[model samples]
Target: MSENNRYTLITGGTEGIGLELSRLFAKDKHNLIIVARNKERLEKVKKEVEKEFNIVARILSIDLSVNNSCEEIYRFVEKNNFVVDNLINNAGIGSFGSFHELDMEKEEKLIEINIRSLTKLTNYFLKKMIDEKTGGILNVASTAAFLAGPKMNIYYASKAYVLSLTEAIHEEVKDYGIRVSCLCPGAVQTAFQNKAGIMKNDKTKGLMMSPKEVARIAYRDFKKGKVIIIPGFKNKLLVLGNKLASRSLGRKIVMHSNKSK
Candidate 1:
């Protein structure tokens, strides 16, 4: 793809850090393809981005949690003859409470969206990027990826997979000039907490950060080709502490936080 036509495709781009990242890229003059399940919200975001940045903004509405969703998205792009220069896998869902107590259907959907679908989409885009030999991928993970999250077990595990997968792919594709970065952010003040049932806890509230702050740090690190972008100094310290802390102690800390929720 020529520099003039380069496009960045961001999943879950209607709100939160995904939306903020879209704004940043739009300001940089990259044509955008923003995906979200809500057509109304997507269209609103599309108009706002177009008006503010004076760039083309495309909205793709699809529930990424559904099986074969990634394939469908790939088909849509191919049918439209769209070429992506950047792929941002930012769509994910979280479930709180004991694993057995959570709704089985919801848990399955979380896995489908947070893990399976993200992986599939990354693979699909990475292949295209490798063929072009010039593109980037950003996978949004979480600080929860570093340790076992007792109440949010599946979500944490899914993020761990994202972090690990991105690192592995970064190593594999560096020679090809393809950049892959995993953004591991701590608590961000987004609808995510409310959706995940995390907003009820005081502990989580204490750790909360604004979505824009996280996006700024993440975007900087991503452009610098950092493989792991952990936003905020405190979050960085926590990740480092977790790595050095004893497994039993770390598990205890994680479980203790869950007890309040």
Candidate 2:
């Protein structure tokens, strides 16, 4: 497929970092395909982006956590002649409190959306990218990926998988000129806290960077072909500190903070 005909497909592209990232791609004049679970959000973003950037914006509304949704998305784009040359797997969920106390069903849904769906989409688009011998992927992970969090265990582990998978694929496909980047931003001002039922912690708020800032950094670094892109200086330091401390110590600190909230 030719470059001009391909699309930069971003999951969860209607809000937060995902929405900001969509804007960046649109501003750069890439034809876009953005996904969201809500049809209203999907249509709004499509029109909003298309108007501002004068780029083609196709919106898909589907719950990615649903079984076979990723395959459905792959098929939809295939039928539209839209090759996903730039895939951004940004849809994810998180939870707070003790793992045992957290709702099992919700946690399971989080895993399906955060890990399973992302993996399926990546694998689906990867085959096409490999065949074309071009294209890139940016998987939105989190700074939590570098540490084991006691409260948000599933969320952290899922992001770790995303980071690990992207790194491995970055190495595996560099020879084919297929770039894969993992974005690991720290706390951001987004609906994620509300959706995750995480209390509005002042510390988290203080550390938060704007979603637009994170998106700008992610897009820039991804283009430079960085395997892991952490957005801010403070976040970079936190991840660095995690590396310096003993794993148990770092985890205990995270657990205590969660319990305090």
Candidate 3:
């Protein structure tokens, strides 16, 4: 079957939650344009998803941390005349360290990839979604967004920005039939922790949600126009508790998490 003109553009779609989300979208016969830095991984995922779901999948290798990467991606999509019906800003990075101990250059790239790229991509496609008045945006925030993460401090702050932005835009564009959602999932079974210098703890594994499970809930909730999507039931409760907890208690909790885990 010929693929539809409309496509879902997912950043960081080569693996983890982004990859699972791609499968979900493609299962419905949607065309996809997946962006990731590793060309080999992107091509592999493209071929696998295309064959498994019998849908067209395109790969775009771009480092979202680079300046103007979002602009470059936007231009590529426009130049190719792909009708982006959905935008999934799932590309992000995390740093695990004290604010003073981390390298500033890496921290800057983390912010660039996690915050700036997401905002710019949304800005580029938001108007088009508004004009079409039939699609949505899913910004992948995290459970870290609710409170200050002492160890992964900048990463947490970046997610807070994502959740805030998604909520504000969700309200702004709801009347125009454009859905916006912030996905705030807790720890997931991905290479994120390893990449971020987090040591594996058996204690955390029990709490971790699988990428596919998180993706399923995220996709379902976003489709239903839910503004804040916290995947697991325990995660929802944690977010609630974080909001109600005293500031000192929250700080102590996160600080302990940093020192121990």
Candidate 4:
């Protein structure tokens, strides 16, 4: 429980929001164990972060979509005797298109990464934190979690699960001196948009926040023990609007936004 021994473990930390969160944590003098799929990027991030932050940065190069990936990570850190004070379940993927026509293989992989791995990893680390009686967890969901996304069905549903699970866990573990938070940012300018084939219309472009800003707000609010952290005013408004509207209307709004020009 000493400062030197505490580490924040982040998944998909080589790029995008995960990378930004890694930087923020490092800047605050938190040691990091960053996991990602690319070896080169991992090495680069490790070197840069350690040099810039004057803190230890460990790297793990493994794809989270594969089976047993979360267990592998747990074993890796346990073998090294790293104490993960905070667990950031930031690794997730998305696919675009109608549900029926989308590739089932990719959809399954998405679920594995976004849902199964996150769940397993949290279960592994959260137990340790509970025993220790101090820790934090930040699960990155999306504003899309508030409504049904037409073209991006599976991805939205997966995030909804994240939001719901994190909320319930926050209540469950608050008495244990552990903090659990759900980050629900709207449109972030990151590689995820391209990978998800999210064609930003004029409206989405206007709503988009940089990864740096989103990560800044997320880390700040997470430290405050905010259960649901929505990064921007527009995103908060969007979620509120969704809550105020009927489920059918919310679905139509998302479907219209997803339509290609």
Strongest candidate by TM-score: 3
Tens-place lDDT digits, model 1, residues 26-114: 88888898989999999999888888888888888999888778888898888878889899999888888888788989988998888
TM-score of each: 0.96, 0.96, 0.97, 0.96
| Per-residue accuracy of model 4 over 1-261 as CA lDDT, tens digit each | 123767999999989999999999999999999999999999999888898989998899888889888888989888988889999999888889999999999999999999999999999999999999999999999998888989999999999999999999999999999999999998888888878777755456665799999999999999999999999898888899888999999998789878762
Worst 10 residues of 1 by lDDT: 1-10
Model 1 alpha-carbon drift over 4 Å, by segment? 1-5, 201-206
Which runs of model 3 end up more than 4 angstroms from their true locations? none
Model 4: pairs clashing at backbone N, Cα or C within 3 Å? none
Candidate 1 displacement at residue 27 in angstroms: 0.9
In order, what lDDT does every prediction score?
A: 0.88, 0.90, 0.90, 0.91
- Score residue 31 of candidate 2 by CA lDDT: 87
lDDT of 3 by residue, 1-261 (tens): 446678999999988999999999999888899999999999899888888889999888999999988888888888888889899999888889899999999999999999889988999899888888888999999999998888888988999899999999999889998889999999899998889888557677867999999999999999899999999999999999998999789878988988897
Q: For model 4, how big is the CA root-mean-square deviation?
A: 1.9
True-vs-predicted CA distance for residue 208, candidate 4, Å? 0.8
Order candidates by lDDT, high to low. 4, 3, 2, 1
